[model samples]
Target chain A: MTLDFWGLGLQAVNVLILVWLLTRVFWRPVAAAIVARQTAAQALLSDAEGTQAKADAALAEVTKAREEIAAERAAMLASAAQEAEVAVQAKMAEARAKAEALVEAAKVAQGHAAEAARKEQTRQAATLAVEIAGKLLARLDPNAVQGAFLAQLVAAVEGLPEQDRAALTRGGTLVSAAALDDAGQARIAEALGKMPGLTFVVDPALIAGFVLRTQHVVLHDSWQSDLDHILKDLRHAA
Target chain B: MNSPLDAVALFQIGPVPITQAILTTWGIMAVLLLGAFALTRRLTLTPGRRQAALELIVTTMDTQIRETTGAEPAPYRGFIGTLFLFILVANWSSLIPGLDPPTAQLETDAALAVLVFLSVIWFGVQGGGVAGYLRSFASPNVVMIPLNMLESVTRVFSMFVRLFGNVMSGVFVIGIVASLAGLLVPIPLMALDLLTGLVQAYIFAVLAMVFISATVEDGTPKSQKET
Candidate 1:
């Protein structure tokens, strides 16, 4: 067996040179590439994480703003609803008051209309009674109706005051519902205590009995006159 | 056929006689250098298929170194990776007609073993210091220092013998078979030699890495004392 130290030395030197060359060409460049890629990836990941954080922050802000808007909207809606309710109540009260006033006015007008109608009816009844009495007296003996009226007139003259009787005794005109016969005039004048200048005037509206009118007094003793006095008393009472 | 132990000078350069093994070694170096240069020409961050393939090779080497040493692969990567590549290419060069693998020669194998021995010491010194590298021999106790020192030389010598013996035997066996059986009979043996060559290259590289890392780790605690 043989070993060559010279050859061994040469081979070792060659391998060492090869290792040096390959290191420069292969190992360093490739390792640098890997390291560069890793660094770039880390940078990209950091940027992405930063962007995600920003996005999350923006989203949170938006959510908070939306919540605030919703709360404000709810508050405004509640306020508006309260105001609307108050307005509705006020309008309702006003409408109720107006309705009551209209009812009161309608009741007053109805009462007035009822009073007018009752007055008209009463007046018509009084006129109807007077017309019926005139017709009834025309059917009766005229002298008997005159005698009954003369008795009423004599009672009314007796109840007169002495001063009023003295004033009524002065000259006056006699108004009769019809042309007065001498006996009717004498009866009315005797009941009136001798009213002077008494003239008998015929008035169809007075119907039959005589009415003596003096300067200060007048005496009525006729069915028509009696009915007229009754009608006037009913008007006053109504 | 020449003896497997013989390295006949094919030529001479001044006082230095150049053997076939040396010539083949140079050719292998040229091919590796050119190929490396060409492959790495257009390296980009975004790699194409060629770049991906180159990266895969480098990444695999780094991974193997990292796994084996448990230290960073950068300092050891160049020497270990080149050693493996050169050995593998040299061993497989036997596939060429009438060409013997340089690793089959005693000188080449011895040179590789010597380089491994030197690298162990270098990395040990680099990881610690000169005194720390020397202190690696005293691991466990000072009593075993002499044995550890002897074991270090013998271990490197054993590596040289193992590589030379395996490659030389395979080549010699194939040569004997081809000479006796008149060619074609050595084909199967040649195929076996390919597997053996690949295994030897892997073993040499792994053993070199282990020896270097072991020394570095062993010397580390003593490094502070030396510093």
Candidate 2:
């Protein structure tokens, strides 16, 4: 309306006082609350971001640990396999050595058995020949001049060639008083044939002693050839 | 001629007929105050039937202040609300049979303009500092310094003239029309007068809010310079 200068001034003063009172009473707390609300919201957002970052870091750490454990497990498994292979190889080598030793022991035992069997066969042959010669000697004469004549003949034959003398020396002569049968003489002749240049002769005074002679040498004794042959075979077998 | 409205005779004070349009204006103010006081005596936050009408007016003003100032309505609530209520009452006062709108006079409009001018300077000084208040005129550029200073002076004058001219023209036109036509024919013209009165009042309050907001800014040209 139409207020004069004084009235208008008073109205202006009234408006100013009213505005001041309203601002002080009503607006201050509302403004403060708004600012506080904004600040709290910002703080809460930052805290959420920080917590999310921590969770991500923890997840990454957990993943890293799992990977490391997996790698360690793989390494352990590989090491175990390698150790198992080494153990298997060692056992194989030990078994190979044991098998080789067993084969060598079997060879040695086989060689010993073969040598003993040869010696036993030689001994049995000598004993049978000696017994045969002893029986023949008992049937021969006890005493006679002829026997002394025979001894003289044998001494003459002992002076023979060295090649023929070695052959007669390998098997000493066995003398028998009994006459040889056809088969027995044939066996004696065949044995003498294996020793060439040696002769087998029997004297009655010698009693079953057979003399093995060459042109210049004679070997005389009962069962002497059998014993000498047996001794020679035994030395060869050993 | 004959003077159409016989303005000197029809408008008067008690024994002295005011040649300056003062008596008609005071009568309007008195009536408006009486009516407003009658409408809202026992004020309530929730509002009864009669109080609800008053609350609607206050709320409309509150919304306008909040939109224009871009600040909480609570901060400048009282000033904006009072300005709106006072202007509304003054404008509506002209609807009475024998009353003239007081705001139609140069003296009354200039007084309201001066109030706005003073409030702008006062709030500016209070918002920042003396230095900050002076710096508001120097903004945009150093070249704008003189222009800004002149603008502040011109703004008060513009406020004064706009409200004065608009209200006075409406009254003058209506008075002329009433003289030409008879009483019965002037009814529509009187309705138009009511609309114009409300518009002028709203313009004055809105312009006052704009001035107050401009002055209250921090006056730091760093932001304007960046733009």
Candidate 3:
């Protein structure tokens, strides 16, 4: 075999040129594109992660706010309930006080009404008694009635205390329910007029007996006064 | 009969002589350059069919380079891929009538081996530094330094002889059979020659890879070096 050194040298140079050309034309750009794509994909993933983190944070904040609002609402509801209870209690107390006051007023009015009714009953009894006495006296003999009354007057005058008798003996007036005869008047004047200025007054209100009133003393022995005392005792016992 | 020993001188350029093998080599280079230009014209991040195919080819070669050398394939990809493509295309060109394959010539095979030899040194120095590469010759013992040195030269020579002998014999056998059997009978031989041509191209590329890796690895055992 013939060895051509010049041909070998040219072929080597040709191979070197082809190798340099192919590296420049093809391999470098393709590799660069691949690396760039990988970098871009990584960047996109990082951005997605950041967005997810932000979303999680915002959700947590919202949850916290909701919990706070719920607590506030609960507090307000409790306070409202307390205020409602207080207002209800106050209304109940006021109503109870008003009821007690109404009861007290009714009791006072009932007492007053009872007192008035008793007074009216006593007045009616006294009038009926006076009417019956007057009828009975009209049926009796005048001399006999005057005699009985004179005896009672003398007895009542003698029963008085010494000081009251002395005061009565001073100038005084005698009031009686019935007109008296001259003898009867003379008897009464003699019984009561130890001092002088003795006068007699006929008063229909003193139904059956006399009332002697002196400047310092008064003595009443009348049906109306006796009935009024009896009625007062009855009220006291009740 | 076309003598496989001699490269036919086709023309000359001033003092530099141009031959048929050089012309054929130029044509191959032009076709490769034009194809690369067309494929890369509108490269997109999203690839179409043609770009996909191109990427597959590039990636396959890169993987091979990485596997063979146990190094980053980037620097080695261009030279290794170019050698494989040129030899493969040159050997297959024999299918065309009246056109001799460039690899069938002694000069082309020698030139390929020379480039491989030079690349081995370049990569070795780049990996190990010149000093370390020189020191590797004295490995296993300084007494074997001469034998190791002779082994490097002979290996490169064997690469040249192996490729040239296989391709030239294929062509010569096909030619002799075509003449003796009057055309139709030589078809089987031609088909067999196609297989032989492909196998020879693969052997040439693989040997070149082994030689370059051996220098870079420096003190690897003989079995690992073969792998």
Compared with the true structure, all predictions reach lDDT values of 0.86, 0.61, 0.78
DockQ of all candidates, in order? 0.57, 0.06, 0.40
| Per-prediction CA RMSD (Å) | 5.4, 13.8, 9.3
Across B140-210, the per-residue lDDT of candidate 3 in tens digits comes to 67997999899888998998888888888888888888888887888888888888887887778778887
lDDT of 1 by residue, A1-238 (tens): 6888889999999999999999999878888887887889999999999999999999999999999999999999999999999999999999999999999999999999999999988888888877887788788776666677666666787778878767667767767655657776676568667744666677766767667687766667766767888888877666
How would the candidate models be sorted by DockQ, starting from the highest? 1, 3, 2
lDDT of 3 by residue, A49-71 (tens): 89989989999999999999999
Instruction: Give all TM-scores, in the order shown.
Output: 0.74, 0.44, 0.57
Q: How well is each residue in A37-65 modelled by candidate 2, as lDDT tens digits?
A: 55777888899999999999999999999
**Of candidates 2 and 1, the better by DockQ:** 1
Q: Comparing 1 and 3 by DockQ, which wins?
A: 1
Model 2 scores a TM of 0.44
User: Which residue ranges in model 1 land beyond 4 Å of their true spot?
Assistant: A40-147, A156-238, B14-17, B42-46, B165-199, B222-227
lDDT of 1 by residue, B1-227 (tens): 76657899988877777999999999999999999999888788888998888888889999999999897898998999999999999999999988888999999999999999989998999987997788788897899899998988999999989998999888889888888998788999999999999999999999999999989988888545466
Judged by DockQ, which candidate is best?
A: 1
On TM-score, the leading prediction is: 1
Q: What's the DockQ of model 3?
A: 0.40
lDDT of 1: 0.86
Q: Clashing residue pairs in candidate 1, if any?
A: A171-A196
Instruction: Order the numbered candidates by lDDT, best leading.
Output: 1, 3, 2
